[model samples]
Target: MKLLKVMLSAFIFYLSFIYGASAMAQDLSQQNKQLLANFANEVFVKKDLTNLQEYLHDDYIQHNPIVPQGLSGFKQFFADWFKAVPDWQYRLEKIVAEGDTVWAYGVYSGTQQGDWLGIPSTGKHYSIHAVDIFRIENGKLAEHWDVIDTYGLFKQLGVIQ
Candidate 1:
């Protein structure tokens, strides 16, 4: 009957729309995963900031208490740490990306030769674990959060008993 054919057509269109949306979401997630990996490598491993604008938004927001908000703040924070820990580097244990958020688990290692967190140089090496969360927007990092083992780092630095 005409009614049965019309109903079938509508159902098919609905199914196609749902499938298309799901496929698009999956593609975005995959792209986000790659973006985070590249950003981490360029920023943390390579310690290069010349191309930071390609990975981070100008109005990026930071949830970490120690670091201020915005891209300039991020660059300054890294500049200070890079000076304090000349050999600083991060080794990622795992990374997960879904929707517009990415989660990274990694260990940071370096030797302190300059002041950090107002603590004088200890001339000692330290390795600390941390988890970073990022929100991606328009192919750039828009917001960030982190949970670091500051206590362990301080203890290793001989700043705590």
Candidate 2:
């Protein structure tokens, strides 16, 4: 009777452990999705990198279509881009996440206020669509892949002509 009771207790504990692990995994996935949404709506649109630093790993790598960069490199790149497009804002269209990966689709619009990529500012408003895929690990962004409408931006800025 003692052995049977002990075995029964062990089985119950094993089931509880499995359920707890599953719940933890689900919670992590939900947290990652929420983090991505906040990143798009708050950080990217508002250009508020201060708060974003918490979620971004120090070794973050960006695979931008035009230029690849690490975390510090992206910081400088955004700084320069914002300098050129002072009124720049991003609107999130869609966001999806699974496991440790999140994908965001958005549109960036702004008026040229300073030089960018050697193109003189024309003070003209431009809109470009963009997409970013991010990988998060241990609750921090580890890497990113980005695509932007570079041709449209250049055309609007009169740099492609």
Candidate 3:
């Protein structure tokens, strides 16, 4: 009857609406995953900080105890570290994305050529595993929380044991 037809039409519309919303969320998740991968490839591997504003928000927040907050702070910290170890490299091992958040795990390798962590360099190479979680907002990185294996880095550098 007419009522059955109208009910079926409404059910179909509801199904389509649910699927559309799910598809949009999936698109956002995929886009964020690709963005984070490119960030690792560009910033971490290539060491290109030329267009920071394109990737990071002006008020970027950092949660690492050693690194200061804000985009300028992040840039300055990395710049100093890079200068101390000109041959630094980051190798991404894994990346995970969910909604506006992305998590990355990687190993950072570098040879010390100058002072690091207030300790004099011995010109030795070291590798440290690190994990970072980033929050994306409006297509830009807005916040970051990271954990680096500082003890491993220090021991590898012969600072301890």
Candidate 4:
């Protein structure tokens, strides 16, 4: 048997070069999960943080403990939560990425007349339930993890209970 047909054609050319390098690493992990969901839809639903180092990652790690770790404390905690909710909105039901991480499950409504985290003006609406996770390396957005609901946004601003 001609050397067993050259060892079964070198094991079928090494299994098609390992499935073509795992399908080119799954298309570069789905383009890094659509570039982190289009950079989280341009900074959380187009609030437009504008090119912050072309999508963060200048030591951007923050775990969201009242957010203050890097990237100017994540752009001053979303610039004081979008200047106390200047119609701030985020909806994302679910999103996920692989090898560089990227996860989201969202709903973040807003309409605060003024202060927050110090809790003051709850002039109108509120909606919480947010979850965020990001990692991404070479393409930026280095590290972040968040979970918002802050006790259902302080019980929908009734200040609690």
Candidate 5:
């Protein structure tokens, strides 16, 4: 009878352990989603790369069609873009995250205050819809893929002509 009680207690403990682990995983996933959202809004939209560095891995990979490469490439691109449009800001339309993957949809808009792609400043204000997918590992962004309306941007900047 004592052995039976011990076996039953072990079974209950095992079940509790499993349930506790599952709950912790769920909570971690939710926190990750919120972290991604905050990174996009506070870092990208706010153009605050100082705090952004903390959330990005050193080996970050970016798979943007225009600038396909590492995190350094993205940083360079942003630098040049910001030089031309210093006030560029993103307005997040939606964000959806599952597991370690996050998708962010937003509009990037700014006034052209400097030269871009050899085009002189037009002082034109433009907005382009953009979507970015990020993969996080160990709570840091490891990889990213982005799509933006480059054609529209070029058209607005009169660079295509």
Candidate 6:
């Protein structure tokens, strides 16, 4: 009878451990999803940088060649781009989060009215599709990588045939 009781107690403890970990993971994923949504709305759609620090860690790493590494670089890239494309807008189409990673698919549209990356303003309009992947750490964006349709963007801008 004592052996039976011990075995039952061990089984209950194992079940609780498994279920508790699963619940914690689910909650983290949900929180990360919400974080990305708010960040996109405030920074991309609204073009606001006042709260950038709240979403991005100071050592944030960017894998895009056009943009430099670190949080300061990310901020500078956007600030310059915003001036170059006054009507620039990013529309998030889909987003998925798992563990500490989040993926966002979106489109970027803008009209060039100022210089950008040595390309003078031609008043040309361009729309590009891009998929961005981000890693979250301590509830903030720690790293970023993206796949953008540069060929299509350049073709639309009349920079290529």
- lDDT string for model 4 (1-161, tens) is 99999999999999999999888877767877788778778888897876777888767889877878878778878888898888989888887667778788889887788887798887878888877888888878788887777887887778978
Output the number of the TM-score-best candidate.
6
TM-scores of the models, in the order given: 0.91, 0.79, 0.91, 0.36, 0.77, 0.92
Prediction 2 TM-score vs. true:
0.79
**How many clashing pairs in candidate 3?**
0
Q: Estimate, for each residue in 1-161, the C-alpha lDDT of model 5 and write its tens digit.
A: 99999999999999999999888877877877788888877777777666656788777887765663666666777778888998898888987777788888899999999987667898998889988888999988899988889899888877775
Can you write out model 3's per-residue Cα lDDT over 13-44, one digit (the tens) per residue?
Answer: 99999999999988998998888888878887
Supply the TM-score for candidate 5.
0.77
Candidate 2 local lDDT, 1-161, one digit each (tens): 99999999999999999999999878877898898887776667778777657778777887764444666766777778888888999889987777888888899999999988677778989999988899998878899987888899888877777
Q: List candidate 5 segments past 4 Å from native.
A: 1-25
What is the alpha-carbon lDDT for the whole of candidate 5?
0.82
C-alpha lDDT score of every prediction, in listed order: 0.94, 0.83, 0.89, 0.82, 0.82, 0.93
Query: How much is the lDDT of residue 117 in candidate 2?
Result: 69
Clash pairs, candidate 2, are none
True-structure RMSD for candidate 6 = 1.5
Q: Which stretches of candidate 4 lie over 4 Å from their true place?
A: 7-13, 23-56, 59-70, 73-75, 82-92, 98-105, 115-122, 126-135, 138-140, 143-161
- Residue 70 Cα positional deviation in candidate 6, in Å, after optimal superposition: 1.6
lDDT accuracy of residue 109 in candidate 1: 97
How far off is residue 128 in model 1, in Å?
1.3
Model 6 poorest 10 in a row by lDDT: 152-161
